[model samples]
Target chain A: MIRSLAELKAQAKELGPRRCVVAAAADPVTLQALSSAQKEGIAKGVLCGPADKISQAASKAGVSLDGFEIKDCPDEEAAIVAVEEVRASGDFLLKGHLPTSSFLGAVLDKEKGLRTGRVLSHIAILEPASLGRLLLVSDGGMNIAPDLVTKLDIINNAIEVAHSLGIEKPKVALLAAVEAVNPKMAETLAWAQITQMAARKQIAGALVDGPLALDLAVSEEAVKIKGVKSDVAGKADVLIVHDIAVGNIFAKGLIYLGGAKACGIVAGAARPVVMLSRADDAETKLNSIALGAVASVV
Target chain B: MIRSLAELKAQAKELGPRRCVVAAAADPVTLQALSSAQKEGIAKGVLCGPADKISQAASKAGVSLDGFEIKDCPDEEAAIVAVEEVRASGDFLLKGHLPTSSFLGAVLDKEKGLRTGRVLSHIAILEPASLGRLLLVSDGGMNIAPDLVTKLDIINNAIEVAHSLGIEKPKVALLAAVEAVNPKMAETLAWAQITQMAARKQIAGALVDGPLALDLAVSEEAVKIKGVKSDVAGKADVLIVHDIAVGNIFAKGLIYLGGAKACGIVAGAARPVVMLSRADDAETKLNSIALGAVASVV
Candidate 1:
């Protein structure tokens, strides 16, 4: 229902300030984004990084975080502490100066991390004029070449995140090169299996269809033109990518070249994780925060 | 330099009518698009399908083809005949009614098919306003789960097509989940090798860099923000996808949900093959033909 990013922000503001637990937030851009988000009343900052670097970054970015909480810790320790903190009291977790390995390691920690017996995957929300909806693309960051079962978890994770964004009964398209299953094209084969599983009440909460090409899944006209019949065609709310490399490039292609606005989050955790890139605009970072906040509430 | 789809078509017209040989030319949209191209002096069509069916399709689309050539052939033999005809006289090929399997069968035929010793691939033109450039995504339609060597061919093929589009030295972004190369990530490994190859002039005609995420590849601001330094970070002309399934879905996600206008063509062939789907608009189909026209000449 949000017509524009501005409206999405307004909706974000109404949800109240989000509690973000930042891990090793020592980078200037990371701090700057967090500072901006805080100023916009989108999120309340919980900085967990090397205290000296964090404060220096804040000062360099001309941000006075007198009201912000700075939890001093080394990068590795910050990752662990941040996740633990978020799991205990915060609404969401964010990565900062820590290495991605350590940052993720902390979150995937069996005892203290936020695991929900589900696959942790990255989903990007992109708004392109071509589709006229907030499209979600998944597993671009976390999962590599996922097997059939991992794909099911990825889809379920994306659907839960979509529901959090208030899209009830999301149309899920398992993308492949063709509409029919081919043994050589593993993606189509996987799509066929997933569709069957969804039909058999295996993957729940989303309408699943696949072995669909990119054009067919999002363009109803393409569907009609191809004489392809599917409930999810041209109306897909979620596009489950075949692999991380493809998803990563495909999602980025849209945002960078396709005039799309995007925000990202790692889903299927006990609590949602904000993984908005430093490259994302303030609006995108804020939207991601809003997305994470919404998902957290859900 | 062309801004919109209209400009792309005008540019196509400036270059003169293209010579196209369409296999299984019984689809109405294909006929209509070709008819428009003919009317606008964008392309010269050689219809290769069942003669009656081609005529019927032309009539169905309300197009009068008084000066066109129609090659009568059954769907089973249409692909081979179309490939052979195009190789002999036509400039490019188009998919019409035949299945992709059959169409590709003729294209990959050992002796008669249009094989140039390079793997055939699909490169989609994505025009997203934020970047203000025609972004090319490849291997989304033809190659499935390409290995390192095949990835090289895909990049080479995409680079060739990019050069034909007047992007003399296109920036090729080898995308992955993150910018850094990780041993666990196969895409990053491939990207690292590809970047080195491009640097050493093994892969010519493009500025290639990667192990980059979506944002870093296209958003220069993101490059600075993330401090991820690379020449291709924010100005990638071509994004070489890992496989067809990912490329297909990723491109579609942009067109359908990100508000982008896309034109798809099979590149890295003897001649670029424009396969406009029945779902694409007149402009998309025409633009693809224009792209093919330019690519064919190169």
Candidate 2:
């Protein structure tokens, strides 16, 4: 299994280079990361944007785009061309130097977009310096406030990503404020329902448990102290939150306060979609590229 | 200002000893923490429970109870007696070895309880090892899912605690998944409303801003990167979450993964309530007692 981000990059390198198509590829940071991934033999670059703007970005980033294929186009039509390129022969997609709405608009276009009849969700893969392993948290960026059915799709997407990382049967934990089902807290009720559904084989290929607090989901000592009996209580492979705020805040808390290294990708799409934020560091962007390359193979 | 948990404990010691009454005080860890606090001149212990059980607990904890005042009572009436004692002369209340429902039942009693016509919320004070400062998170333990009105109460309670810690005007951040007001995300709408209310003087004594992601709330680099312009974008003293799940997960993620030292107390009560969980370590229990003693004075 890929236990760390370093191992993930190594695995991606071993899988050979995959084609990464970047829409509106005029951001210096995106060019730098893609250049690094190409140099490391993890991805082949396909840049789609205005030629002058792409040249200016590559010069600003101090990267040489010698072997990369460039598709010159207008700024408004960059996303369309990039999506079409990925549909034809490219392996995955990346968002760069464009509004998220416009980038997603092209990807979600009815007749020409990459659609799999599934809800789109964001998954964050983190390797906290103190935890000694990789952890997956989902729906932190894509879904705002997901309902029960959307949460099920988010869990399924996370499980698929985990399988691609060589975890055959991931233990999924539905996070809540407390372990018990409180009627006043609506998320707990949904988690309980999902747990039952997973037990009955409605959600297959994972051992799913619900309504666990953050401590019980990760710490064996907390599980023993609380006397919680569950297969995923202390050794959760994936954490699924009810809404975007919880997952977003929780993952960022680990990164900012806990010194965790993290990378994120959007799942439940036709191909892996790497969405890098401006605040993400260089390491996180490169790790995300490697993660997308690995998940694209699956 | 109290920049760290160590400073918080020192300030509590300088404020002299406050009378702390623990309901059903037959837990070894609680006795140990109370004994340490008493030795440090942070608290004067008033143990309210069965005499034999308290004695056995003290012995198990290897602590001396010579200076403590023992209120011998039956197991069923311990919470009632403890509440009445705190109402009569004690400074604050603590939950020792009883069910939380019963303990809260006594505190929320109509006739002889610690009620101030305000809603109760939980506030956690954390000092992440890397941050070099203390952060306050609210409504993580007491309120499950709070509406806008309850959030107002929670923010006011946090501001009061901050004032006691020497911050005259605390910067409060209403945490959400993102900074923008996305109509699909219900919490952003509520945060925008709260921000306007704070500006209108409906919520006083704090510079309140909203809809900030975790990174934007704490990291100046993130604020500069995103070009976010807000008074509380990067230096938030108090973070108010919309629900218990977000706050709970965020706080625990800091403690377990970030190597942070944390302590929590329930606010919006007549007196601060220290409610330690079984999963808490000895240092956390002691820190909580010191926190309760400090907040009780306000």
DockQ of each: 0.60, 0.84
Task: After the best TM-score superposition of candidate 2, give how far the Cα of residue A97 lies from its true spot, in angstroms.
Answer: 2.0
Global CA lDDT computed for model 2: 0.92
Per residue, candidate 1 scores C-alpha lDDT tens digits across B1-298 of: 5545566777778988878888898888888888888888888988887888888888899988787888888878899989999989889898887788888888989999988898887788888755577888887777778999889888888888777777888899887778889998877888998888878989777799988787787777778878877878888888877667667766776776567777878876787888776667778887888877777876
Candidate 2 interface CA RMSD, Å: 0.9
Candidate No. with top DockQ = 2
CAPRI docking class of candidate 1: medium
**Which lDDT values do the candidates have, in the order given?**
0.81, 0.92
Model 2 C-alpha lDDT per residue in residues A105-183, reported as the tens digit of each score: 9999989999888888999998877677789999888888888889999999999999999988998999998999989
